[model samples]
Target: MEERKKFTFSRRGFIRTSALAGGGILLGVNFLNACKESAQPPVNIANLNFKEFNAFIKIAENGYVTIFSPNPEIGQGVKTSMPMLIAEELDVPWEHVTVEQAGLDTENFTRQVAGGSQSIRHGWEPLRQTGAIAKQMLIQAAAARWEVEPYTCTASNGVITNQAGKQLGYGDVVNDAALLPVPENAVLKDPKDFKIIGKDAINVDVHKIVTGQPLYGLDYTAPGMKYASVLRPPAFGQTLKSFDASEAKKVGGVIDVLKFGDKVAVIANNTWAAMKGKHKLTAQWNDTTLESTEDHDAKLNAILNGSKFEVRREDGNVNSAFSEADSVIERTYESPFLPHNCMEPMNFYANVTAERIHLVGPIQTPAGTAKRIAHVLERDEKEIDLEMTRMGGGFGRRLYGDFAEEAALISNGAKLPIKVVFSREDDMAAGTYRPAIKYRIKAALKDGKVTAYHLKEAAINSNMYGLIPHFFPAGAIKNYKVETGNYQSNITTGAWRAPYTNFLAFAEQSFFDEIAKELAIDPVKLRMDLLDNVNDGEDERIEYSAARMKETIKLAAEKGNWGKAAENVYQGFAAYYSHNTHVAEVVDITLQNGFPKVEKVTVAVDCGIVVNPTGAINQVEGGVIDGIGHAMYGNFAFDNGKPKATNFDAYRLIRMNETPKVETYFVENNLSPTGLGEPGLPPAGGALANAITAATGKRMLTQPFIEHFNTDTREVRG
Candidate 1:
């Protein structure tokens, strides 16, 4: 009989036994076969966790596993994808594990952010090190028990087995293992042994999503919670001069109407009451000078009309290239101020007490928002706590914490727990917008082959701008002159889904379409020839691997039957590299009662070391539809310096009927991972534009391409 080694678990819930689960419902996940040493059950699950915690570890008395993750999920499938990474290296069956959110501790973790498509790639190192260290301690304990060499003993799935097959489960000998020192250099598992890491695990929260469970920020309900609304000026830079709040206060359930510098807060017993109070409050606005969304076009035009500014990248003589060309084609493209329009509106709940403040919301950056709150409240950073809820959708809208600050202020002013709820209208009107962009693209093709190209871009700056250098540097372009400028608008614009790449793709890929038509060459072959001619992403230029670009172009063409002909379907192709991955798309479009309808889209992506292929593919499919929606009808326009497209009625969003059939394929690559969230976006507009051109034989150089659109409604206010 083997001597039983007593062990204790520090985790908070009942974990499954080591035994695997049955198939079908439990296809990807199986139950853990739990083994007990000296049974002292684990800590209460509630004691082990509270809101706003991620990335902690615990030991089960009956030896199981505990892991805490700090990021929130808005359907990017990080919950299932991230945990799969930990379980792979820990060699613990997924069912045997119990996960809890880690507390806010700066000393132990970095800022827990989920945007920028950096989730899995960023988490790879720290998590693997943790698993390796634990494996070393377990081996040492087994060596001491059997009086054998530590290296000779093998540990698999929480079991320590000697060369003779005399084994001890983790729980059986953890006390001895806990006493042993942590190893500095423990070997990691080989990639071939990773059964779970690269697999396409289903979303862990799919059940909750499909069941209509209360998982979003808007679904939050707390004891004695009140609602608050704010009265903001129309335009971005406009401010409130004075307001008559007496009418607002007279309404039923309207508690108080408090004034803050340029804004007014309406606190009431319910969301409806606050909304009612907001309407009654008559505020006198001063639009001394403000830029309406309409002014975006004129303002950008003025900036581009000015002299150019240097950004980076120079290979050959660009000035001489254009001068020597026999003929040149120059066209300017425009992208409007678009909204993310995520399903969940912008909201945040705050319970601010005298000493400490509790903040809860569906935000992208919790740790960063907490710090911002500390600065605004003038309190110690540690006193401010965040409880993150799952976002219905983020699309980069949650990156800003102005809504959280609004909640904190309303809670403090009203002297009650307050949930600041932005109505769909208010969300569309007052929220940060995607900056508008305009690009002047020029190309010179001599003897049916491309010779020289020059592009000048001018758009809003003092707004949402990525590094910009990384995607367009010498590595990404050769002899390409990109001059971008920003025309400040009153509309509060920030990062939208895919950030700056959305507009860049619209302009860059659309220009590529025009260039292809000029040379009278097949667009796919032209791109391939250009790719063969230059290196967009290389070590000397930034090392953007084009193998994926080549793979995806081939895939989309083959899948969509690019060269093949069909009567109703018009085909278009475009490729781009962003978010660390290269993607190519072939779009098929047809006219539906004069409305340009995207029928189908074929996508090929190289995201490298895909952790979840299904989820990644889903992003591409969804993102392509989102891109089409923006190109066709989506707009966040303004009226008299105030945003006019305030709700779904005025501001259109993508819906089920509008979505096209999207087929996505992944390139098999062993390179380091890249972002998948925004990589598929850049090709949507160009492909659609090409399809539209093929269908109608009309060139679209402007956004919304309203000329081709059939609508009874006149032009919008902005």
Candidate 2:
């Protein structure tokens, strides 16, 4: 086991404390390592004694503790889990703690974005140290009052007791502790002594979310704020030419119509009036460069066939190994563009005045978005005040701040506070989609063992990042090569969930199964043999731990009863490592009425210590369901640059009845925690595809499995 690093204060004194006006304490700790500069004492503002701090823990006279969570809450449960970290080390009872969301504070916070599942992994040590230091200060104050050494007193569960059994509550000595010097070091609790780290905790906002409270961006409203509905180009490759809004002005409650760049914004007192007025406007568009789905397919195929490629990774003599192979197996897989389909449509509230810019709503990248708004409005970044609201869902869609920028621009142009809203059609048609991609994989088998492997990817807009080629199977194969090519298009594309690995995992895992069949070996055994070839520290670029991955694979197989299911029950298996976590899954299915009926999924994860088991389970279960739903039925396409489906009525999603029961297990360990949000998804598709092939003698090489097979008569379709 790796030795854990001890948390120590910097030589410049990283902790600052201030006395509350009415006999309490406010402790501010610099949780970031880069913040070495001395911090000024927090000043009282508007009678609120607590100022902006990296992580604030305020103790009132009544012994209630409030911890401000610095990161945005995007349904990943950080609002509940992060506060648990601080409360654990502070020795405060869970019921006495209250969690609150903190505003953007660039001076104190770092890496506040919510795109990656990195909140807990990054906040583990520093947040615990914050609570530990506060406890030490309170202990010293109690020892001073007793006229004895601090080592004689112990603090636990909001109380400090001396060796003689004299006790004092934290609230009774908070004022005295606030005036003492900050301690440079405080001992963190051992894992066995932990009271709140690995336990199940309810979501802080569950009651508000379930009771229909105003918590999401669409639910947020400001005083004197007008509603806006913008009209953009109808197609991907089109630009607005001219607009006529005279008819729109005659609508009731229509305040005004303003044009910004190529988009027209309809302003009104209510959302319904704004949407109604926007529908009445007429516009002309230039579609000379419009491209269709057929165009994209042809271009991608051409790239795949051509020799113009950027080699991402190259091992020993791939060509020579292929030439000497006994046989070669090759296949191609394809996937179409996908929308994020967030439950709440894109919306933001902005008030841009001459002196300051106030922005609020659901945004993943708050500080970065504030900077972009400053650049767009030609104001200093310091003039912007940004706050984050709970999001219905992000899934990498809120990472882009275009909606926020639109709100700021509209408010600035109309000289009024504005909240921009997107209708269902607008959200779908104007979304930044997942890039369409095609992957070709080939492997050479010689002397009953795999000898060589090659993979080539052709994508629209952008190719996979450099690190993806170095993931699993790179160090295991002696002769391996990965090449990529791309064709740039006008349509926007960016990160979606796990990004490249989401589809890449399915393609590679399926290819491995085919190789296993040709070699007449069990699918799980084939993977174990490949993993045995990889050694720790052989290559610095390999991020996965072979021992940990093997453990998860074994656990999943044992729990899933691999190769031991009853008659007519088919099983498929897949394992992958991504987002600093290792996951393995087994899919169990039974055919019903010529259609695949998923029954259950067994998953094993090695993400180190589990923080908040309830939240962790929710994330894994949600990922599995999302992966299966998209793989089985999700489909999106474009005709002449126009989206084919604009609403849920046309686009199909997996219904509640189709969702399978998920059984999850974790490989318990003492290592630091890793990400859990996306790792569970990458393996689900591959496992499901393999199970479908086991049931029916057909391999699915395309997404939306519904397209390649007939649901009515169990026959292969075009």
Candidate 3:
């Protein structure tokens, strides 16, 4: 049915309902197609009010629409995507919608965190129904004016058009739409008629980002805001024994040296002044908390060497296969701790008062900030207002509340607004790293078929312990066992890219390469057989799209020229399903004068429905290179409790000349949209390892493949 609403004129101006706040307000919108199947009704976009405050809004006389998105937009491009959903359902021109960075208003906010790539997928339906229901009320208002049936009126591009072609702009219909009862069930547009869903839209903030406009937390300078620098423990679990800030406070711009129980913060008028004050002082550290750069290397090696933990996966007996095997192969791989090192280092601004805390910054999870700040500040949850801003890059590093703690403490002590900035070195030295892992995969095959496989992985499982409670079975392996072991490394580890998949693919796909060698079969063909050949249509749940897995592998193999090769050039392939997206990739590498030089890569994915095909492809391309960076050279060695690689000068990243040409293809599917962000990362690591193994007949279990090349056999140069 065509839907419309009318506007009401008043001295305060006309009150008109809008389809703006990301598919209109979901507060008064819900499913019109509810059966016993639905749980709640849609919100009343026209007349409904925010549960807490009298914040109900209507379209202004000028036809502007405003909505507050609670989630932070870090460079992963949420501002544009979230806004797109709202504009699409509201039937408003995309240009007409204005998104307000939602302040922490729990009563009116949605999930408010942009992690696990759940932003778009989670908001799709609620936003749609909200827009549809709002459009309905607008149509009813126009129907009253035309003296005709409401079903004969349809709304498009903010205009209500009747069957007889009589049309009225939404400004003329909002007040009327507001008066009508919110429809019980509003019809939604089907996919065939969608004008915007799958189309490409330029990033809404591209101009601001390019112009170096103040967008990130670093640029957020409030009036009278003092810059602060905190001396956090070099490693986690270490408490501050004592500190001397007398020398620090003597710096020209240094205001005060505020002590906050565990750490001392030097505050000043400018960031440079704060940094100067910090370097001018010396502090004492507890003996137990202190370790020289070389002290812990032996202990770290011991922990990796002697492992014990729970079995994350198990299938047929590994002992039985080893007992009856004609040949057995075992290889161990190790990865060093890595820092996220997002372009914009960690920074946050917080103003803490006796009654409330107003914290704003480029944070990934505002809701998390609200809870943690409320508890730490000993204030009511309502008293804390968190504002999520555009993030430079989350990559899961921004989830930690350590920076929030610093801001809150500094603000509380100084009785003024405080913004804490972590210098590139501090962000690196004040640890949170990708946990170093030691993986040992053992395979037993006879008659060219794998009978038993055992993968023993050791790392601090602290980061992904929440998300992937159980790993390995998440992958499609028939006879697989994953033994997990944790070592108490002072270097705190957290979710980076695909988290466990980083190590899992390192071990899983590396084992596959060895199994392929033992069986003398193509690696791509072997994985395809594992997914499709062993898969049933419905009976057994593999937790992955086996069919899609097969298709992606087949597609990438063809594009990568699987059956052909050039002198010194070899191809490696890997497939993984994570964050609900199935991805397969092939890396082309060659033993160039000996070191593995990546030439090009071809990747294919089945990510349900591509929300924005270009974005999806770009994300896949970026993720693959990111994974490649980790595989080829991404690492920060931990010596003792401190980082050996503190800067890009020491820690390496893949440069343009080293970056291969990435071609990504999306597998056609009729399924709903899943996430496109993290799924593309896992396969690249394994693909590079497999490609390297193919180029040089060695089971490369370790990371960076650098140590393997710098082995006793010979050294490889770039």
The candidate maximizing lDDT is 2
| Best candidate, TM-score | 2
Residues 114-166, model 1: lDDT tens digits: 68887766666555545555666667887899999988888777778899889
The root-mean-square deviation over C-alpha atoms between each candidate and the true structure, in angstroms, is 7.3, 1.8, 5.6
The C-alpha TM-scores of every prediction are 0.88, 0.97, 0.88
Q: How close is candidate 1 to the true structure, as a TM-score?
A: 0.88
> What C-alpha lDDT values do all the predictions have?
0.70, 0.87, 0.70
> Where does candidate 1 stray beyond 4 Å?
1-54, 211-214, 308-312, 462-478, 535-539, 593-595, 711-718
Separately for all candidates shown, the number of backbone clashes (residues 3 or more apart, or on different chains) is 32, 0, 30
Query: Residue 544 error for model 3, in Å?
Result: 0.8
Q: Over the stretch 204-257, how does candidate 3's per-residue lDDT look in tens digits? A: 777787999987889888899999988776655467777787888889999988
Runs of candidate 3 exceeding 4 Å displacement? 1-64, 107-110, 235-238, 289-307, 461-478, 536-541, 566-568, 710-718
Clashes in model 2: which pairs? Answer: none
**lDDT (10s digit) by residue, model 2, range 1-718:** 3344566765343455555666678776665342436555555623652325665788887778988776889999999988888899999998899988878866555567887788888878877888888899899999999998999999999999999999999998888898898877778887777799899999999989889998999999889999999999888888889999999998899899999988999999999999999999999999867777889999999999999889989999889999999999999998888899999999999999999899999999998999899999999988888889999898888999999999999999999999999999988999988888899999999998899999999998765343288777888899999999998887888888888888899899989999999999999999989899999788997888888889999999999999998899999999999888999999999988668888999999999988899999999989999988998888888888888999999998999999999999999987778898888988999999999999987898999888877866966564
Preferred candidate (lDDT higher): 2 or 3: 2
